[model samples]
Target: MRAVTANALCAGQTRPGSGGRTRVLRLLLTLCALTALFAPATPARAADTTPAQAADTAPPSQAAYFADRLRENPVYVTDQLPREVPRATAPDFARIAKKTGVPTYVLVLPMQSSTGGKELLGAVHDRLGRDGLYVLIEGTDVAQATAYGVRAPADAAATVALYELPYDAGPLRSFERFAEVIAQGGEKAADRAEAARAKSEDDEPAEMYIGPSDRSNQSLLTGTLLTGVPLLIMLSAGYVRRRRRRSGAERRLPRWVVPGTAALTATAIALTAPVVFDQTRSSAARTPSPADLSARVERVAAGLKQDPVYADPESPRVLDARQVDRLHDRIRDFRRSDGGGPVYVSLVPQTPESESAGDPDLFAAAVHAKVGVDGVYVVADPADGTIDVYNHGLRLDSNHLFLDLPDSVAYGDSKADRADDHLLGERLDALMTFLDETPRTDRPGSESAPAPAPRAADEHTLPPLFATDFWPGLFVGAFLALLLSGIAAGLTWIVGALLRRRSATPQSPASAPASASASVSASNLRRTAHAELTSLIGEFTEPSNDEPDDHGEHGRAWDCLDAAMLLVEGDPGRTRERDTDPATLVTVIVLARAGRAALAGEATEQCCGVNPLHGPAVGRRHVRVSREGNRRRMLPVCDPCRDTAVAEPGGIPDRLLKLPGLESGGSRLPYYEATDGPLSAVPDGIARLIDKVRETAGVH
Candidate 1:
């Protein structure tokens, strides 16, 4: 069998009722998407910290190296817990460095310091040239872990995407989960590197699927739909029955159209939503191989870390001079709140004698060495896309800086592009936002007091687009939306099936008019008419509790109304002008029902003409269905009858009382009110009564 082409599908949609189906499908698809967007989510919760401890406040030159992992000896381990470094967890740090080929460092402490982590990480990152990942493990109330780094192999990067660390599950159970990830990720990186090396040597032109062309395959499908469908419609014209009406059948599209359209639209979205909203559009930083870039960054960092390079270079900046003062002011404010950090900005040239060419971390080191580790330093080669940020003496870190980072600068997803997220000016603004957002801790002497974790209003928030949970969340949300849509579609189908089955059964002729008149109840008409009469005569009679059976409890309310209606219809004041005029009687009955705004639909047949009780000359029976808001109601347009109601309270026709539901209800409610009074908001049965009465009595 041959497969149907896309053109066939498009042509199928051009059939009758397609436009309406398309609109409904679009609406359902939109609703499904919106439902997915609001799916329940769990936000990243910040870790709790103990009070700031007495930190190692010594100068960088006098500091001692903790391990051979880094030559700059930037790692800091606090002994406040007697043995803060877990024997098992510490090995994983060394393992990460070995796998990634960049120097790794750790800061194991019992509490956070008044100084921010960003300033410290910046200083280390500058000296190390973003060598490897930085791990900070705090064991206050519970063990908490936070990881930071510049770049790693794709495999290694995937492993370290930790929002918060599991309690010491790695190496002696100190962030053990993070360690396992590193090991798994490291093996992947090694294999990937080997594969890439093998692929590079192969250079052969390969067979292709399709080359670039002026004519697209997609266009052929479109063109076929545009021309083929009309031809088919024209050819099939003779097959259509030429009779005025076929078997007296009405032309309806059928019940399946609405649900079928909704299902198709939802399916299309399910197929396409992932492509549109699944992943962010970005490219990785310019690099040859991941390993090569790491090597270059480390080499540059070594030169910048040397004391001579840092001290001698009073770095010139490429920043606009006018903005320098504002940056300086913001940095000073940063130091005041963040417990002081070395801050400086430098622009390096790419000559062999200076920061090296092809890479930019060297320029960052040169600036950091000169400025020392007591402040913030930014090193950039004006030709490159990123500026390295480093800080010393300050206690903050870069995690809090991403959000504060200015959006004015064109940035990239650094994991892929290796480009800067912010320009120098924007970087300056981010530094300011960081200080504003970081929690300010009091000086170290307040040890006796409970250390309150720094309260940041918008501190450390992950952008939903880049959120760790975003991808998983999308699948979960889509599943829920599809589930709900399916349930609703099923319920609608079941109801439609039941209705179609009932409609298919033949309706009896005797029951047709009775079913049509079901809109107005006999009791409703009788009670309302009797009330109107009693109001007119200024007398009232209440029904008793005696067990009486007319229709049930409500029937008692209309018994008096039944008698009153009989009296009025039987003796409508015998006279030629009033008695001979059936139009006047009908006009009055219509006025009563219309004035009360009671109308749903008229009886199928002319009840007044067929019945022995009705006046002569009433011929046709036109119906008024229940007013489905803004729909034109079926009102009797006889001018002769309308004039009778227009005359006075005496002009109301007594014939209205004989109608099914209107009998007990007199024309009084509509009687006193003017013909032009606002349409009444009576019950549905009452509203239908007027149209039924008018259509029945005023048949022309």
Candidate 2:
């Protein structure tokens, strides 16, 4: 009609004569004004309809439809139901209801309606307006029943039926079990229920019902084992090393000991980890709190800001590419329409954190608060094909939409009606159409909607990604074990090296001075002492055939050489501990030199004051040694050392043996300055050397 009016106005304006155009235009304007005045306003929404009128006009709800059907037959079974409810099982249900001796109404549907099974049962009972037992068996393995003015133990019968039948038992079998309890009176059913409860109690593992205190105790124990085992292994190794060190043995563990112990600790922790993290304890109803909700809302809001359709792939319910394209197109169409701000269609799952918070309106409000934009939000739980629609800027009444929409699209249809993917798309389309029809209430972003109240705080904290999972935990533990093993091995190597050096050198109460040259290998010194002792022994062994009275001196010389050899070569037969210390080796050399003097008839008591390993002293000199501070002492020295000391009056020569400190590890000093044994005492007399060899060789 508007097009014809427009064409008529245009044709009138094109008239050749000015006078004719003026008349035609005035007439066309008058016709257009009449047409505008006569057009009616857009149709009234159902919200505006009176309750009586709405009741007269609105189609029957599923609960009412089922109730109406139950008026004709006691057993109502849909052609399509959950696998747990076998097909064509209406007769079996009817038979069970007849045996109960009272009117029993059973409704078996494939899935739950928008209203839950309990609510449906109540609604159906009210609508039927009869006294009987009402039962509803729906998909998702839910069963609900109630009795109105009936004498049956509903709770006991239900409990008995649930406990007696397997979870996967067909609805007919469950109903039969339920009927059996009803046929037997309340007392009998109660008894059966109690026995079934006892059996279930026996079947349940005690670990399943572990309390918070018990769980905490278990966690504490597990943590202790995880950390304490490794620490204990390290402590044990240290203890073993300490005992050996005190026993005059090497203070180091074997190469594989530390690492092997660490590996065993990690293995024990890994094997027992399941006790702490019981995945079976995780409840499906575990929902996220308000803090967790904020993150998910913000993520969706951010995505929606970029693209209207937020299809989360990680969600249990993911939209296919085709469904995404369709949703995207629908959103574009919504935006192009009047009163449209933005259309956000989210295909996200009912995550554990948000599972119990299934209110799409709450989710929509949260997304809007985050997005800071007025829009139509559609949140779908693809797991069960449940979709929710919320309008922020538009004047759409959600109650009216519910009233107007078909049962199949409004409440997701049964699996037989449509596949989940198509069902979601169809619901979205219905919401869009409803949004287009509703009048505008407010402008987009003009006023902000309040955010939804967050869920209560949950007792359990959300586990970090892969934190409690067996494989991931094991992988992390193994990696940690490897790291600990490397550290242990490295420490073992460093400690072993320090101990070997400490054992190989001499240990004394006093520290070695800086001037000592203790770098000479103790083994080399022992070999040299061994050679000298052997030569001296051979010399004394000749027995001097020309003088038999020379036996006493020769016997003394042989005794000193034999004792010196014992000091150089440790008594491996008695104890494996080597006696070839650097200071001990120096003492052995002194002994050998003293024995040589005994053989030559020019026996001298003193050796070099600077280094006894330089052989026996020939004379004495007044020189300042670093070990004696500024005091000058007449120290006995060898011929070469004496010559050097006399030539350089300012300082002593640098031929002192720098042995390890007599106080602790890593410290060093001159042998004569630090040691109080053969090296220090022998410069005054060969008596200390003789006693040391005699004691070491077990000689009187």
Candidate 3:
């Protein structure tokens, strides 16, 4: 019967695309599905359950199975079993276990229940029936070790590794650290644990402490931005408005324009003032009543009972994220050690509501009374980075807590210079280490230590970063913004009134000197050029009642005029010296002159070589110039400029328009020859002079 069944299975596997083989596979699958539906739950089915439920359901059966596998190979990893630890982790476990010397078995599996520790180790040892060390690792978080009939201090070594290392130290590192402790075996291992803990504490970077200088700098920056930024923006807006009005037909705004803008700016500042500044009750007036203090203590005690670290959410954040984590880690380490009771830490701002007495020790005692537990109670005032410790009932040598404060807390200068959030945590961590190492007496109160001296307040007038006045700086900023805005609006109104009066009173050409107009500042040159351009626009755009003799002449004149208008109109207000402003102004002058000449039935000529702003050329002459390789060419020259060019050595004209050099004052070539301005593309009079040279020479 066995031979017939084996031959039939072999025939199904060997035949390709056979109907019999397909039917046999389908029948086997159907049988599996039916068996799973009707039969009792198996190990495969139990794998889908939660770790806690699976742990509680069948520990003995699972242990027996794993023990048998361990007997074959100490590092047992199964594909049939579900585990958080990767299959690749088996080699690493095998290597670590081999080095331990003692008969060691490490089981890396997914067992997240509380009893997955010692209980599971016990069951596995019972089944394996070996006098050896057994380790159970749960995912990458928990690790438990047990030695049956062996000399390893499994519990003590595990505890030292668990709490001494950082909270985020993974399972492998924990196991490695645990193995090291086991190898040492006794009191030397305990000393090694203390050294590791001390090193970890020393290695952590201290949190940044905001000091008096930081507060002052912050205030100065905030004030300047709030006041200066708005003032500059408003002034720029006014300048832009004035420029636009001067450039266009409309030169004056409505009477309400300036006043209304000022009013709106003031209203905005008023609306934002409350939100910008701190609106909480003044710290000076924060003395809480007896009822409030008791209520606060009761709430703190309740929180401390659940978790050792109790920080009031309503208070200012004194303990940052890292400080809080370190505090919790230190508490856990202390709890796991012998001769130490529960530790309750309260981090609160020094307020009447939070503290009954002004002192931290008194406040801690009050909290301890409500807690109704015999343990160490710690009260910290994070506002000034101060703390006090109290011992209610712990079987240690000392009833009084002796704290060796850090230099920052001990000295006045360092304390004033640096105010750290980690100060409280550091002090608490030191206290915990001291409590753990201190030898216990036979009975409570058998030994008493001297009380440490009270810590002195730093002799600095500048308030800590937390307690700085937020309202004063904002108030000053709003006042300045309002004052400056009003002054600006008043000045605008005054200037407008003066200009309106001047327009009403007409001035003849005799009253306004040509010299006065010629001596205009560089800033006002754009406005002067704008006025001349406007007149030129009117001449070309406005229709003439008298019909012209030549229609083509008028058309040509209008074309030149249009080109000049486009040049002047391009990107107004970008009047940088190196920008297109100089080119645009000169081009407008040259084009306007050509239009006037075209209208008069005269041939248009190139602008003078000395200055394009000198209008049309009288004639052309060959003037040797070193800028053009000392070559002489027929160049346009105005009458006065022509005479000046003749006077200069080599007849080289000193051109009026010169662009800035790469590093020094001005370029070696004239502005038009440089081919670096907006007018280079446009066929203006000066540009036409260098057209062939620029195109053939590749100057552009």
Candidate 4:
């Protein structure tokens, strides 16, 4: 059977090995085939080419071509002739004309000489008749000569220009070219002239191109309707849509999303609010009627002249009637031309003293009146001879008036010449004449309409609803909610865990049967309690008494008492008689003697006890006693001790009595009996005796 089993095992192993080898060989062959199939093909090599040959065949880059073309040209310079004579004469012109085969033309320009002299009298008339070269003399300054590049000698009297015109040029073209040469230098003359002409054409003031009144109105209406209505509607719709979307989103999302969404909504509202506010403001600023404007202007004009307007306390100054009239005219003209808008006027006073205050002669004044009125109105800075014309409650311009007085009147300390008075009189007469010509009108009551109180900033309309307080409150609430929920969940989990552990725990086997197990457990508990009590006694004992006294009585007594108590109390089934046999009694007596010896500070015998065989028998009882001198003070014994019927009375017996045992009776009590005498009458009398000895000996 072993051989058969061995053969079967060998067959199984051999078959698996042979089959595995065959599979491995197949896999290797397949891998080799795959590797061959997937191998990369070799790349074809490229033909070599030289840099120079390649560059020659390749097209030039745009930048390189441009550079080559730029390098092929040489720089050229040309000079142009002037059309007019220079303020000073030119000496290089002749040499230049001869070298270039261009005839020279001389132009003599006039000058304002400090010495009175006649103007130029055809000084180059003979030279102008030349066919190829013409000399033209015209009044010119240094600017004209400089413009033509005509360099003249410092002492020369005239400038000369040489021209070479094309043969087919007409007179007009010739003159135009001549002017061109005078305007710019030779090479760029034609280009400069063309540029200047184009610029002039471009710069020419365009006529106010107003469409037909009806057509303009219609176009404006259409544009306003198309743009304004759609824009307003779109903006309003966008605002509503955004607000609604944000509100919906806020309701759906968590608290954190609300702040950012509210911010965005507020920004949108803020942006659109300005446009609405501006529309209202513009409506408020619309121009009043022309009649109202004219009346306002007249009232403002009247206020300007006799209002005793004060310019400054140090220097007395007021607007003259002429200035007021001029201001009225400017206002009327502006109203007629520009409709109604805000205008600013400046009054320039010429006074040496006023000029010294670091203040300019120009003083600005404003009037909130309308245009096309003759009356004077008192406006800002009415003390100065500055009258501001206003159109539609907006300032237009200021009319300034300068004071003119006789030199004697202005500067009384200085001598006055007749010529000075004539000049002053002429100025004053002009002023008075202007004042006389000024038209007057009644003051308009509506002109002084108080400006509406400025509206408060819109932001202060209501306390910010979306204040920092709002978000923080929400955040705190949410955080508190989350925190409370987490705490509750944690508490629940802990309670559940504790409950599970409590449920899973098994009861301790009903504490076994209280006979053998309980006795043993009780004995162990008593031992532990005795040990703890002994330790407490030790702790209470003085450190100075670590070594036993000369008698060693207290230490010996304590040791005996502890041992005896441990034996009696530690055994739950033992009767008290056995606990206090004769040997035990002798030990307690000896302990009492030891205690007396310790109190007397003398040596005494150390008390000792041991268990013995049967002796006197007595019933179980508790006894207690107190020690006095060498005797114990006993307490009353239990009834069980006196009752002869009770077995083991007092739970101890006298040591001299014999018991029915095989061995001779020892000088100790039987295990189950009590003591017979009144000495053992008290309950726990021996224990009480030991305790009294311990207390007297100060052994705790």
What C-alpha lDDT do the candidate models reach, one value each?
Answer: 0.35, 0.60, 0.55, 0.31
Is 2 or 3 the stronger prediction by TM-score? 2
User: Where is model 1 more than 4 Å wrong at Cα?
Assistant: 1-272, 275-279, 283-289, 299-528, 531-700
**Tens-digit lDDT string for candidate 2 (1-700):** 9787687774554456688777878888788677666654323343244344645533355567787789988887553221223334567678878988888898876444344667778878898899988887664222787889888887788887777765535456667788889889989999999999888876731322333444454554455556556765765576556544432232234768887887787677757666445543322122333343355577778888888887653222344444555667777887887666577877765432352245566767777778887777777765566666666665455555545655665566566245635467667777677667765644332224445443333333333222334344344444565566567767877997796577556322111122223245544555655655555666665465654332465655665666665665543221112454557666766666667767776566666777665656777877755433565667787776777677764345345555532322433244565665556666565766677657655777
lDDT ranking from best candidate downward: 2, 3, 1, 4
The most accurate candidate by lDDT is 2
How does residue 688 of candidate 2 score in lDDT?
64
lDDT, model 1: 0.35
Question: TM-score of every model?
Answer: 0.21, 0.32, 0.25, 0.15
Comparing candidate 3 with candidate 4, which one achieves the higher TM-score?
Answer: 3
Candidate 4 weakest ten by summed lDDT: 74-83
Q: What digit string (tens of lDDT, one per residue) describes model 4 on residues 1-700? A: 9666544443443334587786765565566566556654321111122334445543343223322322341110110001122111233333233332333333322221211212111212221222333322222221122111233221111121112332222222333344435434353554544554555555642322222332334333333333333334434444444443422211123444444554555456545533432221211111222232233224333433323222221111233333434444544453344323222332222221121111222112122222233332322321222222222222222222123322332232233232322232223334333333333223211233334322322211322323324344444544454555456556866996797477445221111111101011223333333343343244334326566543354564455445434434533233224333332333333333333333334533211111111111133323311111222222232233324214532222221122222221322332223333222222343344455434444556
TM-score result, candidate 2: 0.32
lDDT of 4: 0.31
lDDT of 2 at 443: 36
Pairs with backbone N, CA or C atoms under 3 Å apart (clashes), candidate 3 = none
Give the better candidate number (2 or 4) by TM-score.
Answer: 2
